[model samples]
Target: MIRPLLLLAAASLLLGCAQQTLRGTGDLGVVVERATGSVQIIETSHQTRLARIDGLGDLSHASVVFSRDQRYAYVFGRDGGLTKVDLLKQRIDRRVIQGGNSIGGAISQDGALIAVGNYEPGGVKVFDSKTLELVADIPATPLADGSRNSRVVGVIDAPGRRFIYSLFDTDETWLLDFSQGNTPKITRFKNVGKQPYDALLTPDGRYYVAGLFGEDGMAKIDLWHTRRGVERILDGYGRGEQKLPVYKMPHLEGWTVAGNQTFVPAVGQHRVLVMDSQTWKQTDAIDVAGQPIFVMARPDARQIWVNFAHPDNHQVQVIDSETHEIIATLEPGPAVLHMEFTARGDQLWLSVRDGNEVQVWDPYQLKLLKRLPAESPSGIFFSSRAHETGL
Candidate 1:
């Protein structure tokens, strides 16, 4: 009887081990299927798709943020859906309609809270990261006319458990500190610029810059020195030249700082603007294939890759970081909406919306390695973003 019991216990242990699959979350990520309202679980190490989870709701303008542990993904959908997906389980763990229209979201530094920026009601809502419970609702500062709350854009996580964003209608930048508790201490910077469309936080969380759509320059605030207020940089970038009609608003979040220089997309112009990071002054502009949309840096900061808007979206141009020259140009496909680099920068991924595929390439060689079929893919976010600030 003792021998039989020992054998049964051993058999049970074997079954338990067989039921669970051991893997790390570091290599895991999701590709947004914009048209289907779904995401495909993918593994970067293998460059393969693991599974697809659906019912995310209106991903036409979707973005994702990862938990500190990188086990879950918080997807912000255009139709106001905030979904918490368990990467290990390959399913949605919890979901809530947090707003009427949310463009993007960010997770706190400690991974304790999730913040969603809204457009309809024009406010930011904070939620408990674990339970998806509303922790705080801070409306956007109302305009001077007091008719409506200004639309919030460029919601991003910063150091010290804080959130930084821009007010479109009010021309202001707000810094919300949540380090104390649910009640946040707010610091507002007024007169940032006209029509502040989008903002980006430097990798070190030192500077928060907003792109001005209604003017020629950008509004920058040195987080390390907030008393100086908003300082305009790259002023008169298009002053002496006729500006072309903007096909799409250039996204500042894709701006890159390689070494002492910063590269950004010139709104309504077929050029990539290079800035001196230390002085916050325009150094040079490199002509590109089209009106640049995303001017992103490779992980190692050796090369800057750029894509365009609308009719020129089929091509991608690579620029050398040091010389500020167009190194190479490749025709990826139609409607290249987004690009993401692997954690180590060895591989680069491009989402071709019209092509209905994601292309993985060897950045150094500029050669296509593989193509994965996707349905109107827009954003390809990896779990590596879990550790980075203001992703």
Candidate 2:
């Protein structure tokens, strides 16, 4: 009887050990399954899907941010669902619907707060990163007529525990400093431009620039010198050219900086604009296959990969950073939604929405490495983003 009991106890111990295996999340990432309202957990090292988590609401335009520890992912859905996903446990730890329509979100410098921007109600909400509890709710500035609150866009995490964003309806930019307490000290920069559609923060977190959709330029604000106010750059960039109809708006977050030059997509144009990082002046414009949607740089900044909007969405063009010329053009498939590079830039993963799979590529050789199945994947986010200033 004692020998039989001992054997059963030994079998139970082995089962417990097999069920809990230790691993690291450095190579782990999540791919947004937009159509199914799910996310597939993937690992770069193996180039495979580990698991798929579902129940995330309305992920048509979803975005993700990682916790400081890289063990959790905060998914911001278009339906205003803020979900805290446990990457290790492969499940959602918490979820809350904080607004009517959410566009995107960002994590604080200290990783204690998560800020989300909304489109319907028009405001930014801050929540405790750990508990997902509301910390602060900042309504967007009202229009001159006091009709409605401006729609918040370009929400990004900056250094010094600050959050900076643009006002689409009010033509303004704001900086919310939370270094003090839960109540933030707000700094408003008015008359930024005609319509600041989207914005991007430099990798170093120094300059925050907003792209104007209603005008031909961008608005720049130097965080180091807030007293200098907003300076308009690339003014009259499309002065004489007959603009084409933009089927889809370009994403400023995809703006890339290679060497000393910044590459940005020109709205309603089939060109990628290159500007000097120091002077903020247009250096050259490289014509591409179509209206540029995401103009992103390789992790090492050696090449620029560009995707396009509808009618030309089937193509992707690569540009040589130093030569400012088209190096190669490849057709991955229709609806090349997003591109993400590995931490060291060795592998490039692209979400081919129409193809219903994510293609892994060797960026240096421009060779297809592997393909992982996904359900209408749109965004591919890695754990390495936790350390980046503005992802």
Q: List per-candidate RMSD values in Å.
A: 1.7, 2.0
Q: How does candidate 1 fare on TM-score?
A: 0.96
Per-prediction TM-score: 0.96, 0.96
Off by over 4 Å in 2: 1-20
Q: lDDT tens string, model 2, 32-151? A: 999999999999998989999999999998999999999999999999999999999999999999988898999999999999999868899999999999999999988779887899
Specify the highest-lDDT model's number. 2
Shift of residue 179 alpha carbon in model 2, Å: 0.4
Residue-wise C-alpha lDDT for candidate 1, range 111-145, written one tens digit per residue: 99999999978989999999999999999988789
Q: How far is candidate 1 from the true structure (C-alpha RMSD, Å)?
A: 1.7
Clashes of each: 0, 0
Name the runs in model 1 displaced over 4 angstroms. 1-20, 144-147
Candidate 2 structure, TM-score to reference: 0.96
